[model samples]
Target: MTEQEQQTEELRCIGCGSIIQTEDPNGLGYTPKSALEKGKETGELYCQRCFRLRHYNEIAPVSLTDDDFLRLLNQIRDANALIVYVVDVFDFNGSLIPGLHRFVGDNPVLLVGNKEDLLPRSLRRPKLTDWIRQQANIAGLRPIDTVLVSAKKNHQIDHLLDVIEKYRHNRDVYVVGVTNVGKSTLINQIIKQRTGVKELITTSRFPGTTLDKIEIPLDDGHVLVDTPGIIHQEQMAHVLSPKDLKIVAPQKEIKPKTYQLNDGQTLFLGGVARFDYLHGERAGMVAYFDNNLPIHRTKLNNADNFYAKHLGDLLTPPTSDEKNEFPPLERYEFHITEKSDIVFEGLGWITVPAKTTVAAWVPKGVGALVRRAMI
Candidate 1:
């Protein structure tokens, strides 16, 4: 075996279960040389992320490539398990794993939409679940059932457990999701409810926190496996700093801001996304995003110069320091024949009227698309 592989084979992190390596600080299961030596002597080892989380309540972001995640999925395809696929209700598109249906083989899928509490209370639960089910169907997944719950708020978790029990069919359960969809938090909630342990897994706003599979024993000699979150590179979480992520990810229910715009007006969602009314009557557009995120209005004519001049100053979260490194916004034009929401994946959406032509701009790697209005 290669030297690094041999070293890794010798020691695994007690916390996350990744094989230990001291070579690359940013790599999975990385420990400092001194820490490695100490861990070897003591037989008590935690990777840097787990160590930081345990000692300082801090989270350090780590990422694995698409190939690595695909390998994990391939392993799941061979297992006789019930796949519990969790998605963020607010970021349904971003939470989708490409080819997930194919990867799950003949195993049943239970779709769980998390962050339900982030949506306005005016939206009914039945409607939300219906929407989630429809979206999943379109994505080629036929979930046995769809459940919406807010893992952070501890809402509907018990119902979710009961549902899992009904459909799991005495098989092992595998929970899978894209990074930052609150999968870790949901698993932690399950652990707490079952074993009375709190925060057993590291949960963080930063993406890709869980680097290895964590298996929890079930009473029926089965295991509930919490798999590593698959990284979606198109997400805003990949582009922003941890501080900026905190500013962008909504923490509570979003109180949408409505704007009445003429054909020539524009809206800027901080420096992260831009919306222009290229053609349409003066109409109302409602923005659903983090309540703390800044929204600025300006004439369409001045939009370009305004973004160039004030991106870091008036427009923030590519805040002053992040602006230089931030990817340039790429334009997407949409002709809206029906009432639709212009979604900037992982950022938020703006609901616009029917018979309108609009344009959206987001960071180059991020996605911007139009979908039927949710509310």
Candidate 2:
């Protein structure tokens, strides 16, 4: 093969920057032979998987194996780089990378909470930042600074860039987060603001769009690196179909729904979750979740039978194809001594008043958390 011909064969995907290949349908960067031929002529192309995800909202599972992700994380251990940890404000707990402390390796991290526009405007910024810091501290992450922004809406992007520049010390900045947390979207905005290039990296509502690291050069000789998102087993994005994800993932600012309930009443967040008011007076239990997601009410005593009979039908969001994949729900009972939120991880939370008793249930692997209310 001639040298020029060999170089042409090594072109990368314009979408996610993975080395373009025609082999292994389930592997990263798999484009079809016909697509590659067409790309060669046009000089612009996306892998088949990315094309489907972007256009059709159809996800083709590609393994970002734990070992491979850990190896990529190891690259930052000794490097003089600043870590830009992005997270979805809506799914803050699920977006957290488990064992992040082991990977950060003494480097200062700037925690940038993305999707701030999805939050209610009445929710104070200082309160949210404080809650984030407390949660990070509990998780053993000591971030030097925290900034909130909505990448899609470009809210606070300038302030975020300024914060990044202040902390980076002219070193390479590594942008990292769990899959579906809007990491790619945030990086794309930064690129556009810095270089006026829209979507320098491929992004979509689906997880795992980026398969490898993509570097963006800065005018000051430093670079910003976009790392592939790590998949957390506990995230609901793993269990739901792409179509159903849109039903649960909040598209706009959340408006809390308050339900007046007495003891022995229950509320179901579709078929995916259940909340039982085990012991409480007739008081308001406010629920925060995607506005479009359906909520059903039933007697606590009949909740079990109700779920069993109507799981995929009336209580929906399993959407037929995803119903069979649903794992048995696990229950977590809590007695609220103070104003606390019963967090359903990838889903939203329920804010119960002090002195209320509630039991929350979610898919087995997707656990729930009880935290002091942020609002």
Candidate 3:
């Protein structure tokens, strides 16, 4: 580990395994090096891993107890702030923090979809935008605008900022998202792209940040607020060990695949996503997901045993919680008359290989359901 990890490891909670850094949400796990110089106490305060991911995204995932991460989201309810909520293009379902709009009542929320670089190159941008808007609607949000961007590629950053400036109208704007959705990265880019200024803000690994918020000042005397990202529900991070989180989370571009399937065949898209026969024959099925994840094909007859034998090792995120506690594999069968795109949640999407019927499966909570073709 590095010096920062070494310092953070010195801290551990007496009741839980999480670490405590700054109470600043943007600067969660932000302990000044000078603070440690004062002295070391032996009671065990917060966990060390929390410190690294918070400040560095270095992957120190701590096991948080219920109270450990159940932060005061209601605090924002009373603030008259413009909400800029970011969601990962991949893992959209897992990234959703429920009751967000209700908690921040009357706040105008702008849902920004980040990491568009992972999508298939053939995806039609406008159609995808509409799909995202529909998802936001289902999430109980009437966003002032829904913008798609890739912080890594700097795609659509200018347009996003321009729109935000127009809507912001001299109001305090807060950026929030569930953990691992690239919220900090987006904010970092926004600072550099919009202002050409570099300012240090808070970030951390475990959710329910120790720090409450970070403020980025604008020229109009308005402040752009960066809030702590909440831990997502049913995410692989929550299900897997720290080692697994690194292995599963994509750090690069994704690759899409096309497979022709019959009635009795199964295609396993990595350990996190699966497809089983629900009775479609001669169906053209394509899948889009992260390239890092492996895709294994097998006969549907052996699908169950294959999953049982290779889960985590193969069909991963394999129940860090417990075997039965994990979502059972779910199967969905669909018929397509035309060429279309089939998305596999955090995984990339597969283009239909033309005029074939197919079935797909995924863990119930990992979000492998099919949406309208975004072609």
Candidate 4:
């Protein structure tokens, strides 16, 4: 390498695969100037963000550019690879990456619905798989297969590996998802299960942990590539702090909460989301969210003032960090002619019965949608 080449030579963090640089503190892969210099001699480095996550279980927000993820998708489009598209079963809408069909080209996609451990044990796997396939088809992205696995619990991993092997057929395997979908954890589990190497890649609840794709060689001459998660603006993970995330992101199985609401009643999901029964008869609605998250109910007429007065206190989950940056709640109205789930993007959804009318409120850009009920 020439002197000019040395100056431009890319150095990536071994822990997270982000290209190391010293200029911008807030940019991806930023390290102090002295640390960068020291790393050049030691050959082992972690970005400032990863260092804290590794040591203190703290996550500093550093977003990966959409262009970088797009470039990786473009590269994968031309390769003969098996696309293992991982999605969080709890937050399906927020986990979806739009335009994925255009980028995957002709590759066979294997939809891996992760976080199965968070669901009730009584929930049948076949029903969940059918729902996944239906949602994929509705989004115009068809998968050759759909498998449910809880990467954290290491459940159903061997069966997932068998499915991967059956479809990969001597091609590279690419794992992809929007941020916070447990893609990194799933890949790490796969690595440990297949290669006996535990956690070769860094894992965290934060988005953009893997700034670039990392490839690990397989015994069969094929490789498994872990791509940096695409940052979806609608994902709540982008707006939330680490403490708020712990409260909303369920760590254990979710026990569904059922509420009976009349036409003029409202329910609040922490301080992050709200649901109003705009024009429905007295009915039952089932909510699935983090067990620890607080749920508040009040008359619809009092909701506005209640939220304005007690947002960070009684409503909870706003914490100090998110209180200022949190955008005003935006409403998405729905006239549910059929049974459907009113989804609050990264937050869990409320399943409403047919012939009900409702409106959902979430922070701006944190999406809300209504889909045919998966249950």
Per-model TM against the reference: 0.93, 0.94, 0.73, 0.92
Tens-place lDDT per residue, model 3, 1-375, is 666666666463321223444333343344444443432453323334333444456653333443333454565688777788899876676677787766678888888998887766677777778888888788787888889999777788899899888788678887878777878777878888866754233343334442345567888788887665676655656544454456556666665566777778877766666666445447666665555567788898898899888775655555434555655666666665656555555444555544455565655765544455554
- Candidate 4: segments with Cα more than 4 A from true spot: 1-11, 21-45, 320-322
Cα lDDT, all candidates: 0.90, 0.85, 0.63, 0.87
For model 3, the run of ten residues with the poorest summed lDDT: 12-21
Estimate candidate 4's alpha-carbon lDDT, on a 0 to 1 scale.
Answer: 0.87
RMSD of 4: 2.4
Compared with the true structure, what per-residue lDDT tens digits does model 4 show for residues 1-375? 666336525787766788777777888778897887787788657788777787888777656568978897788899899999999988888888898988899999999999988988888889988998999998898899999999999999999999998999999999999889889889889889877877667789878788888888877898888888899889888777778888999899999999988999999999999999999679999999999999999999999999988888898889754677788889999999999999998889999998888999998879999998876
Which wins on TM-score, candidate 1 or candidate 3? 1
Indicate the residue-level lDDT of 69 in model 1: 74
Candidate 1 vs candidate 2: which has greater lDDT? 1
In model 2, how large is the Cα lDDT of residue 337? 94
Q: Give the TM-score of candidate 1.
A: 0.93
Give me the displacement of residue 232 in model 1, in angstroms: 0.7
Better of 2 and 4 by lDDT: 4
Clashes of 1: 0
